[model samples]
Target: MGDDAPVVERVVESQLAAFNRQALDEFMECYAESVELRIDGVVAASGKEALREIYARQFSVAPVRADVVLRIRQAEWIADHELIEGAAGGPTMSVLALYRVRDGLIDQVQFFGQRVTE
Candidate 1:
């Protein structure tokens, strides 16, 4: 743990705790009310309400659990891989995410790559 551990936890917990119990509302609390979210450089979602709409439309058939702290770098940023375990013992989906934090909240999340089944 470095000097920024508390800040890291603030951001990370806001991210992980929110989604712990299959609660979308909880999952989203990790973000600021005025967050900017982008996926694949195509879809753009700003603000929590808009994100709610976007999240509602996007669904996955796999089980995804957050792996937020694969590595936490400077200024409270973390590079992590989210693992999605699916049925059939088939493949796992892992999404590497980079979160930018401010004041212990996620201001922006830039992530890419489809779920990788490993």
Candidate 2:
């Protein structure tokens, strides 16, 4: 682990807490202004404005929360295996997210997810 490992972990943890609380502003605080969000290698949202728009819509529709099942950290990167629930009445989702932290903020995130089926 590098010197910034704790910083990286704290940032991610804060973001997760903010997300679970639906605190958009607090959530955004953990992200960089030029943040990029990717879903399955495809860029979904770029910049804070876009992120706000996307998350706001989701927050308005339903209460969504993600529980981290596993986490791996190395230097400035953090990987999380998450189980997400309460997404607009849809089935729970199992998601793997890789976050890249820069200057104590998350500059990029790549997500891979699948709906859980019985």
Candidate 3:
């Protein structure tokens, strides 16, 4: 963790807010053009376009309505990035997100998540 931690955390926080609002464009603003994401150890998406496609599909399938609650349980800095863990409820899910932020934007993210039953 270093001074970059704050920048990393801010980007993650903004992105989470965007997710809660179901604002794809704002969500995308946090990422770099060449961003990459790995989901549960699998390389899920590469580049902004792919990211847009993936999230667009997600929102269309299960749009996060106003009632849905997206919460960030923690944001911890380790090395050059921040590890963000959270849950989205109203269909509860747990998520661990590793975000690599560089040059003031999220350059990469590794995500692991599971659906939880209440």
Candidate 4:
């Protein structure tokens, strides 16, 4: 671990913390206005304001949790494997999300996830 390691760690941690709490206002603070968010290969959102709207709506979810693990950051980019425990609108699920950071804001986000099967 080096000095930069701690800084990257904070970026990852802060992102997850705010996301779990649905704090896009705070979360987007570290992002640029041209950010893009992709989930499961679908263009869920683009642009900071638009992305914010996508995430902000999550605030309405009760008991929502996005448990994240294995985060790696290089310069302005941070990649992570995460699980979105809610968003089914009626059912619970876990989804994988990968974020690409530029200028401290999310330049692009890709999510790879599957529903937990019985």
TM-score, prediction 1: 0.71
Q: Candidate 1 on 36-87: residue-level lDDT in tens? A: 8877665588888887776554423334445543665666677666764442
Model 1 alpha-carbon drift over 4 Å, by segment: 1-3, 57-63, 86-91
Q: Please, what is the whole-model Cα lDDT of each candidate in the order they appear?
A: 0.65, 0.95, 0.68, 0.67
* lDDT per residue as tens, model 3, 1-118: 4666677778877886897677999999998999998987898998999999998887766655322234232334322222222322245455556677778788888866566555
- Backbone collisions counted per model: 4, 0, 0, 2
lDDT (tens digit, per residue) of candidate 4 on 8-115: 557567777887777767788766678777777878887878877777767765546776666666664566766566574545455556666544455677777777
Rate residue 32 of model 2 by lDDT. 94
Ranking the candidates on lDDT from highest down gives 2, 3, 4, 1
Cand. 3 Cα-lDDT = 0.68
Best by TM-score: 2
Compute each candidate's TM-score over C-alphas: 0.71, 0.97, 0.73, 0.75
Worst 10 residues of 1 by lDDT: 56-65
Candidate order by TM-score, decreasing, is 2, 4, 3, 1
State the lDDT of candidate 2 residue by residue for 1-118, as single tens digits.
5789999999999999999999999999999999999999999999989999999899899999999999999889999999999999899999999999999999999999999997
Where does model 4 exceed 4 Å of error? 1-5, 72-77, 88-92
